[model samples]
Target: MANFGRVIELTIDDMIFKMGTYAIEGTIPFDNDPIPNESEIKIWNLSPETIDRIKRGSIVAINAGYRGDVGLILHGFVSKVLTKWDGTDKITTVYVLDTDDISKRKVTDIAYAEGTLASYILRDMAAQLGLPVEQFELNQDFKYEDGYTANGEVTKIISDVAADCGTSAYVNKGKLYIRNLRYGADDVFMLSSGTGLIGSPEPFEDEDFKGFNLKSQLQYRITTASVIDLNCRRFNGRVHVRKGSHKFSATGDFMTEVEAILP
Candidate 1:
């Protein structure tokens, strides 16, 4: 079902078969889409540690490991064909080399599918402090309410509800396995029911502290995002993202409804 439009190609060892262990080094997307679509396939999967740079007729670039932070970049193609002449002795065509072009080092790598890849890694760590990735807009919602002060002493007044896309104390832990791609069938994995209860955040605010130390200075925060709400659109393809309006939200199963063969 992957004929998308027709240009599907792949071979830098089949786009490294979705680098499930990282090593993708860099990548960012939003080419604006001219065609192709089958969920646009973000963060497909990767594990061999990646760094091979990619070999054999290389071309590579297929989304990324599951939960793919979702920015964009799942184009495809790479083929010289796995050659072999029946006449034996003079058939050579498997070659692929030069190619690198990529971005994105940490969004906690997807931070377990948390709110748009940690809001694009907190807008790439606030564009490395200089901020202004087109100026203020990576989400900034607020809603607070605090309670507690009468006497029992438990009157908590907590209501700093944020849901736009402009904050993060970056935390991550992922493990997706799924199944039917088959080998037994019940793969499983996909954890994080709040991983034992969201308790492990302390960027800083200490004195003589005894944990995670970066000289005490700290600033990291990504609030919320986790999309694809059309009932998950069959295995995940409706091209989600807009949780709090980071933007981009395509459907029709995220694109391709027939024909797809990109590599």
Candidate 2:
């Protein structure tokens, strides 16, 4: 049995991404839950470009291995605060909100990807599990610069939502992310000698880079942001939201609210 010594029960939400046996965790969730300390929440807090790149990276990682199911965001606000065993890691046990909870309103069971070799199989998971745009502190806003033709026609380049626009998510150093993805069935694959199979990007350096796959379809990074913004409405307390789904919503906040979320 798990130890229950001098136990104190507090509630919080959590997220994790599954790529084979490896899982990358996300933030703790709550719509308006209070966090006593600054360390309680750790949104990327990077430059706008970096934030976008992280989002793009997440999109790429999810879609890179997307079979069907969408990635999860275990979003919930802080319910109760604890003062003991407070390690550097910002984590706690959430109440584990369920669909039946009153304040949470609608709750849907996300498939555990029982059959697929990866973690998920439900394609609409991200779309169904996203939060609203209003609550998105992701800093995803974009800025526009203007250029003039020889005749001064005056053209503008939207550095935010265009392909190869170099607006990808930010990572360490000077590298940016390219989170493009596609799910067309006509895709083809090549096998690697040592690693087995990886989606084809370009020719591999060694003979082991056998699985050079390619896709004829394309989708935008913005499309990904919208798709995962669903379920942004559900919060903890009155309603019992699901464990690993979005509860805040930005469905109609497109023009003003969402625009401000960009880098």
Candidate 3:
């Protein structure tokens, strides 16, 4: 698709606080691991009253894409808000954490009976933490042979349980997801020169996996654990996104970067 007319919509506490791309700038990252994602957004020139209304723990959601197409990019809670003057232009920076409440909550002495499914345990934990379930699928339904006891932070407990089941758990847009490591979301995004694939996909290798790092015109649909069908000069196939980020700036830098691996 042809990329044009950048758009950004930032909503705080269920109110549309800012819209348009020219004055909004920052990075929003998504991950496939078992931790919450954090985003930092800086808006230029906001009234003092508006900035004051944004408090810690307030709900925030950001939507960004081209004018004709837009999607929810980040939905989370505000962790901090800071304002300052930059050469007479006041800038308000908002720091947000995805699923902030669930990550910090502790599960104490929660016990499950033997022969309990991991999914059941996960759902129970989600209820205890007050997190909504977006998607939950395990390659194998692991049953606790000797039952199980959950403790510590909810994220950690979910991570440990997922590890035992040979899967990964993560929260996206305020919901929980548990799936196999080699797989991703069901919807696949086709990326090519005609569809906003910037330059060529670069080959990369790390200790755990080998994959490609790709850049495209700020794709709001692509997130961590998303499937992308990459079609370029050097490579053509489907890869699962391990991690990626969407970045927009007033300086004309608007792009999506993803590090994906073969599944």
Candidate 4:
């Protein structure tokens, strides 16, 4: 079991925000189910040097975990920034989007002719956008029937590709994981009872009768992706993490709310 404590660190470009120096409260979200994952961090008491150094398009890194075992949970580019004054203090909120979001900004100038395999089209598009093809695992057997037209946004093109093949494409960590809608054992992480698991895992029914029931929910202090093993009753074997949110506050409350599906 790991020690009980909070780990929160943020860096923009090369300027690192030391703990107890600038940030006060923030939240970083992680998900790989379908949509692109993004994070919003609200920080208080930012110095002029820090504010001036950070701007839109700056690379940002957010790390959080228990004491001594902190990991880089989110590393992406800043999409937007907002600063406001609450009469007593200045609060700055930074919005960050993963590499997948950057792909959305690119549009394909060439079209995929019919008989072109989906994997080929995806590879071509990804290459043009500077995303390494090796980072993604695509279904080579899937082919385009009607072919695609030019001037299509890379984001939309990829979404259509995934939907046609009944798969999903999302950036997990720093790589693009494109695969069928099946959660394999390779996606497993440990959430021991006393290590990071906050309390008992609570079982619940899905509000909407669509997809698998996200039957289990728990909280932890670690921030990372992958299926989590819940050491508890009602949730045995591997459970898929459907959604998770990381909350980090300089005041010492740092945790992640995890929603998972029963195997």
| Predicted structure with the largest lDDT when compared to the true one | 3
Which parts of model 2 are misplaced by more than 4 Å?
A: 1-18, 21-27, 34-67, 71-263
Q: Name the candidate, 1 or 4, with the larger lDDT value.
A: 4
lDDT of 4 by residue, 52-169 (tens): 7788889988776656667777877888888899999999888887654645556746767888887777666555556543235544457767876647566567667765665566
What's the ranking of the predictions by TM-score, best on top? 3, 4, 1, 2
Candidate 2 local lDDT, 6-32, one digit each (tens): 111111222232333221222222211
Error of 2 at 142 (Å): 36
Q: Please give the lDDT score for candidate 4.
A: 0.62
lDDT of each: 0.22, 0.20, 0.84, 0.62
Best model per TM-score = 3
Model 3 TM: 0.91
- Where is the poorest 10-residue window by lDDT in model 4? 209-218
Our tally of clashes for model 2 stands at 47
The residue-by-residue lDDT of candidate 3 on 50-159, one tens digit each, is 88899999999888888889999998999899999999899999999987756678878988898888888887877776777777778877899899999899888888
lDDT of 1 by residue, 135-178 (tens): 22223432212311211101010001112222212111111111
Local lDDT at 211 for model 2: 18
Off by over 4 Å in 3: 1-3, 14-22, 181-185
